[model samples]
Target: MSDRNGNPQDPDNGPESPHRLIEARLQKMAELGESVELYPYGFDRSHTSEQMRADEKSLTEAETKVRYPGRIMAKRGTGKTLFVPVQDERGTVQAYFRKDDLGDEAFHRVQKLMDIGDWVGVEGKLFRTRTGELSIHVEDFTFLSKAIRPLPEKYHDMSLENRCRRRYLDLAMNQESRERFRRRSEIIAEIRAFFAEEEFLEVETPVLQSLYGGATARPFKTHHNALDMTLYLRIADELYLKRLIVGGLEKVYEIAKDFRNEGMDRTHNPEFTMLECYAAYWDYHDMMDLMERLMRRLARGISADGKLKYGEVELDFSQPFGRIRFMDALQDKTGRDLMAADDEEVAAVAREHGITLKKGMGRDKILDELFSELVEPGLVQPTFVMDHPKELSPLAKAHRETEGLVERFEMFVAGFELSNSFSELNDPREQRERFVAQKALLEAGDEEAQQLDEDFLQAMEQGMPPTGGMGIGIDRLVMLLVDSNNIRDVLLFPHMRPEQS
Candidate 1:
């Protein structure tokens, strides 16, 4: 007779079970408050359970008898016998149970209570089922945890809205979501390795600053009681990282959590991860080369090829990234050179394009608005739009060839800006002037203008080496690499409005 409790058969008080048919027999459990408890307290970790179930075909003869513990993903067939698909984190395997083997009472238990999604451990011999599926034939079994709620039916309708809202359910059922995350991990690993090989010292910067002066973006402010002052969450790590360069760290990088008080869209997030790096003695040109190589490495690992197919666009990372001048791109699209265009002419062009160029809107802001509305959406390939007007790029050094433009380049892929690099300004005087100009702009109602970071200026006074700094939106890059159009798909948990209480 089969021992349900794995104990000697009793006659008089033999299994004081309910009078009703034992349609389902729970296996002897090692968990606390469970049947014939063998463990001391919590039994979350199954001691005898195999670390990872090996494929039967790949396993040695001795390994074929391995017992595995996992959740039941699916169940089919019943009556005198049952077939259940058990899934551990690594993979899934089928488990078979029979009425004759489990005996009368045990067989009934299997029928009623052995529901899908319950965690169970089975000590079984590996063999091929008559259906040609590799399966485990139970010698003995144990209950791990009983899942109270039933999982969604595998054949149930799955909608995009439902998938995003109930991500846990989607994760349990959708293989695509699982694989995307797996690739995300690999991509991060490859990026870290690449940075390490380049001798870039990864450093952490302050998240909450007394004065937020990094990038030109609105800041989320909060109060600190002990200090009795308002603190602003960092929008970028540029200012702080550059300060480190002044303090003698030649090459430094920060994989920072930057918070932007901005609109949430398909490509924008309020809080995001960015890989910002600064290298001494490197210019924007050199930075672009490094960036291309890093991107190629990431694409190679993500797809195991130098190309990634993203939304009808096959982006080939192997080929040399194309370079285009910002003004030339403008001239190409607008039939007028930016340098030759007066304020009136620029405003006329803006009006023609239905772009609202406000009163006292400087040439730079007009150009920026025009670029966003017209030029940006057109850049679908891996193209670098270089030599931005000086007013548009505050931190970048003045261009060598142009009179009023900066040596900066923004790389776009699949119509999204992936990376922004610049020949960083090393002149303290010029840098301070730029900050003063920005402060004036801020005072004149341009809240998104860069702030005057006195500490950063002081660092510049101490002499920072000529540097090339770059910031890459990791989420955007991941989206491109994974061929995901929606930014939320790349992010594990995106910000959502609180539900009504």
Candidate 2:
């Protein structure tokens, strides 16, 4: 077989020959007793490479003994001494392996057994190299695990499709990918801490449901053979979490994995993380405050002055985010008052703006299409677009002052919707009416319409609090904080198409 460039495709004969390397590693393993037990489950790593570097001066003076386990990143200086770079999760440290220091048997073992990408634990004394680089001078070493396949030469610069498909290699070879995931964890931890500090109870909601109702998105469906019933992977956790609120768990939040049978894009994924929080007795206005504080806290956790760069723009999270009424923003951008316009007028405007209108799209859908095309791109700075039309928000409460708008807001930054908040509609009758309207749209070929879940309405009838609810796209939030352009850059294992044979 040949590659696209007409190069030989056989792994055993190709450059950096993965098949040949794997065979050699297997042989080496056989020589060293070769079972799963050869690779021990745990190693006592006294300090991380990062910690050793931080305490370099003190440790070097004290001649402190340390045990560190890491993947061998690079090896140099073959004969008398070996200078190897070993990387753990935190950072990388250079290891100096001298024949005189390790004596003959151990030095020969290190040379014969170790390879780049192999996992090893080294017992060493902390010191600094002549060039002032923090290093560990090894006294002895233990082989932990072996890597059979060769890593890509320029893995960091590999194509995005390959990076997403082989994320383990991407994480191993690219430091940026490793650090981005690290920051993702830290960001989520800070978010949980912020909610906990605010007296919110962290809760879990079911990922599989008998009926899906919460967001307007197509759901991934499955069947349970035992129950002999069809089920849908949750498109959102809003309905279930609100049920918890009805069951008297006030101020509840869930960080959940939401699945949508949707198209993939820079921002959209089939499976994604969502942070949904509902606070009792609060309104959309209060949600706005909470969203701002949460974003600011995340910025402060990752940056110094509550400011961070997303692509070319420097987002300032310290100051209050800007706000624009949804209809006003639409009017300002497209020079059309969509709220006041009839369906035909809105359709005309959409056509004039070169926005493609799907079949059976209503006035609200047309207006939203226009807003996404014209208004959303200009909202680079943190801005809240509030008071959406009633048709655009089925679950949100009707606006207190506006005639035909709902108390709903979507936070946008860098041309992407980061968070959505609603003054939840607790009236069972009103919610039922909204669901009926949604059912009409669904029957009219809109697959992304919310389904009427009777149980949820029963819960509402039993009485749900006047709640303020918010759903933040956690992946997008991580992207903004980490300056990642693609959502997959932040997601550890984003969905990808199957490889063609």
Candidate 3:
């Protein structure tokens, strides 16, 4: 059924649904118009549920002094007494109402005005119930805000798609959802604290860029009306952070939101958070140690034992992380030396693994697909896959010991790439050649190609020190740490397709 506004309604709840409940609530507001201000300015809450619980033993049950506010989540009893679970940010407590204490007229008025989703401030004293539940005995109550529309039904109309689209409902109804987001916030704070202690300057980079480079991914594009030039949402923070390195900022990091014109999956999102860090005079080896320490710290910070369970896989961060050269690991998985393989041989490997690439994608791209299919999943524990092909790492410095590889390491965990680091490419001429090669790939139909940003090249020419730069997908890391299955599970506002009308 359609509403008066021409919006779709749930077929299962034709009339006695959220729509009818909202209509009933609107009528209640109309009836109580002259008697109450349903939407009050504010409530001066003296104690949160947590504070009340902390002082649970000190406060007298007979005395009434505390002013507490929370949303009425659940209600019980239809007679002269009512028990409702009131939830604040920290936790929930029960509010006990008696008609004798409030009188019949006021009590009946409350029954008329209050609903499960309404916010209320209670003037009450802490007490222990007959069942020993910590609760509040109300002397007086004030309506804070009326929830005109009821919450989604517990079992119906609360699908995953609906939850993502209407996160407010999900958060209100699901405590796990609320706590997961809180954990996300706390994890981020811990990261900032860690960086600060290590003396890395937390910095912000431009989200809107004239040219996007630093990653092999397409960027979201826009045009600025005032400037009248095209602007692309940044896909990586590596280039700008390296520019700061050129400016002689020894250590810099940015916790940034990067936008990518990409596919969405359980692990991938179009828009995501990234923690990019760069330090001068450090190589990928140093970065490997830093990442391992950071991960160990973060894992222990969230998990008490530095061990985590993601799905059925148990990851012990307390153990030393495994490391392997990228090409060697691929050869072990494929039983062929991919580096020595010709185009036809590599194409055969790709076909064997059920991999399909864009028509003109480079050999390295094909190799990456094959590894992603065969090797990435078995890298269940924390593992460093090091020294990728120079063709694959356009921004990484060439491997000093190897002929055609770059000093790069990608950290993988729980079947996903968690972080990537490089001994940043600093030679201006070499960097130019790398960009030229990437341009050739771009023209050959590889859409995820780096653009030659002259401005950045000039920064490099002015002299950038030997620097190690790393980018960690904050969402993906949060997922592994929190055991959240989907990218949307960790993100409060994950990108979603529009609801069908």
What does each candidate score in C-alpha RMSD?
Answer: 8.4, 3.2, 3.0
Model 1 C-alpha lDDT per residue in residues 347-422, reported as the tens digit of each score: 8888888997677688888988888888999888789989998897899999988799999999998888999999
Ranking by TM-score: 3, 2, 1
lDDT at position 426, candidate 2: 94
The TM-scores, one per candidate, come to 0.87, 0.93, 0.93
Question: In model 1, how large is the Cα lDDT of residue 190?
Answer: 81
Return the lDDT, model 2, position 281.
Answer: 92
Model 2 C-alpha lDDT per residue in residues 188-207, reported as the tens digit of each score: 99999999998999999888
Number of the top TM-score candidate: 3
lDDT of 1: 0.79
Candidate 3 weakest ten by summed lDDT: 1-10
Residue 464 lDDT, candidate 1, scale 0-100: 91
Candidate 3 collision pairs = none
Tell me the spans in candidate 1 whose CA falls farther than 4 Å from its real position.
1-54, 58-63, 104-110, 157-162
For residue 425, give model 3's deviation from the true position in Å. 0.3
